[model samples]
Target: MASVVLTACQEEEGAEEGETPEVSVVVSLAIFDDFARQLGGDRVDVPTLVPGGADPHTYEPGPSRVAELTKADLVIMNGLGLEAGLEDVIEENTPSSTPIVELAEGLPVIDGNPHLWLDVQNAIAYVEHIHDALVEIDPAGAEAYRANTDRYLAELQALDEEVAAAIDSIPSERRKLVTFHDAFPYLALRYGLEVVSVVVASPGKEPSAKDVANLVDAIVEEDVPAVFKEPQLNARILELAADDAGVEVCTLYSGTLDKKVDTYVKLMRFNAKELARCLG
Candidate 1:
């Protein structure tokens, strides 16, 4: 729980003259990495450990990556047990003096879910936390950071309205969601949709027969038109579940973004459009 204040760059202490020393930040998630990059602008260097379209829940970095992380001034994580596999490596490799900011900390937790960024308001909160951390680490850049945060927050607010309108287009009874895993509870909650069932309790783990059976039953009973599959995960299980329920399987960007859903705002709009098409 170290604050970002511990990440004051050493380069700032001995800079000759007029050189703006960049703060190096190691972010565990791609989305947050992009956020830091956008907000940090020229003042920060963000190297993401998890690559684009990689599953954070099961991603494990090699020794080289670990060494890179050890040298970072700050490490940012989504927290809430999302990066379960990388926890030990992140804990052991990061330098003692470095600070780690968990963006989802202090936010509302529902049913122990960690996908807060799926909710636009929570994503705004993330932007605020990241802005505060960046300003704390480099107090000289506070004004720039505040300005960047304001611009991004405005974009997020507009995207939130877009998501609401898209979801509203779907009939109340049709606004049920079934996904490859429990990835979209926050999205559903925010958009007035219900997550009827998930094909797997956790990604990368095989679903038991009971789990599949229960999900199939729910899908059939709820008349869920489509089951969503994530881009980073294998769609075999979801396809099977959808086939069993006599429904179609659509793609959703749970965590990592692909070429189609590149930025955070684009990711939200893309998912909203898909949900509208499938459920409306």
Candidate 2:
């Protein structure tokens, strides 16, 4: 959902400042890490503090994570409220000199939703922020970063068009979305789907029996063809609701990723594919 960046740097143990030392960029989510990798190329191998298949909303890094945070040369995060937990820890423990860049900060939001990257345009914005940050932190790699970002940004623009066309293939009436959580509002807005309801309004809040029943009722009433669940969250709640409503449960990539969906473009492509298959 969000991330914080930290950097660990030295002149390669024996090298001097003029040498091109590999950047140690640390970000909070797998998505941001991928962006850094794409832009940084061989110059950086960024580590994602929150591993894949973990929900950033409720994840709390362990004690040893502080060492990494302290040593980071640049730390990037999706500010706003996505990584509030990590933000608190960074404030208390990380050194004041640790350079911090938030990818989602200052971007437009819908009702303050932090999942802005769900929209391809917003994802592009995050990539742009990352591109700028990398250029700032490692002036030596500015040309590489610029070139990589140009190619990556162009690919994302094409992806945006592809996703739009995919969504447009679904019948208008079947475009309603009932997701496992509130992560899809931005995605829904972008692709013309309406978020009819969510099983859990927030992460870590399991739906009670009554809540599930209510969601089932809403699903039945909405008559959406399918309900979606994120890969990293519990699908049982959505499965139960969908079963009772006689609808299919499909997968959507949201806050986190798995081995199969290891990159941002793949994540978005997976989402559009699942949506079209289930609802088209």
Candidate 3:
């Protein structure tokens, strides 16, 4: 009878060992979640803290999201002050045993601009980071992660070359960028362009009359041709300021993904195409 009981217990343990627990990933934004999905393949499930079209700088995760973070196997974040509002929640909810990966690790980060994925090279670095983190979390999926990262890295290299060609079409003198926020420094740096001035210093902060006036003077001084507004933010103020400064207003994606440019590759291409159209 004792032998029979031991045999039944061993059978139950064998069944449990064969079961695969679902791997959970909590990403700070949609783009990172998308990247995670690409690398994780079908082996992992990712939940985004910031919804599509939501600004990462000001996004606040709700109770449901907090619970998701607590149970996640891995937590991915942009990690350059982009998710300022949800940092507390991410820290508090995530278990110490769970691995937290900052996708922007090893990328050249600017002091104030957290939009690292705007530059294709930075995005490539992010993919590498994601790949390594996923492999560490699920060693069984290491080969898949490496293969996916290599494929994605090739695409990013192609994108880098495409963006370079697009920016090369613009005259060096016409390569000035004026935006609603100081978000595109990495993009400008990567493409050999210049950021003349930004309307606001921080996210969600509106430009004052005096601030607008100062930007107008700088724009006139720099002879900037276009002012770029982020698609996720209200552009009325930027439009009015651009009119005052005698510059055209164009749209750029900052922290959020838009419907048209849903993927990271598409987002960079869209920005390049728009910049070429406006500045070329």
Best by TM-score: 1
Give the distance in Å from residue 8's predicted Cα in candidate 1 to where it truly belongs.
25
Tens-digit lDDT track of model 1 for 1-280: 2444444444454463346547888888889987998798877878788888889999997777777787787889999999998899989988898888999999999888889999999999999999988888788789889898898899899999999999999999899998887889899989999988887767778888888888889999999988889899998867887888799888789789777778888888989999999988
Per-residue lDDT tens digits of candidate 3, residues 1-280?
A: 9999999999986676535544898899889988988887777889899988888888897899889998999999988788899989999999999998887767777885688888888888888888888888888778878998898899899999999999999999999998988888999999999988888876778678898888888888998878899887877877887898777888888777867878888888888988989988
Q: Write the per-residue lDDT of candidate 2 for residues 1-280, one digit (tens) a residue.
A: 1222222233253355435547778899999988889888878757677889999988888877766777777898887788866888766755676688888788877887789999999999999998888888789889989999999999999999999999999999999989888888888888899998988877888789998998999898888899988888878878978999999888898988888998999999999999999999
Candidate 3 stretches with Cα past 4 Å from truth are 1-21
Ranking by TM-score: 1, 3, 2
Q: Please state the error at residue 155 of candidate 2 in Å.
A: 0.7
lDDT of 3: 0.86
How many angstroms is residue 111 displaced in model 2 relative to the true structure, after the best TM-score fit?
1.5
TM-scores of the models, in the order given: 0.91, 0.90, 0.90
Q: Pick the candidate with the highest lDDT.
A: 1
Better of 1 and 3 by TM-score: 1
Of candidates 2 and 1, the better by TM-score: 1
Q: Which ten residues in a row have the lowest lDDT in candidate 2?
A: 1-10
Instruction: Please identify model 1 stretches exceeding 4 Å from their true place.
Output: 1-21
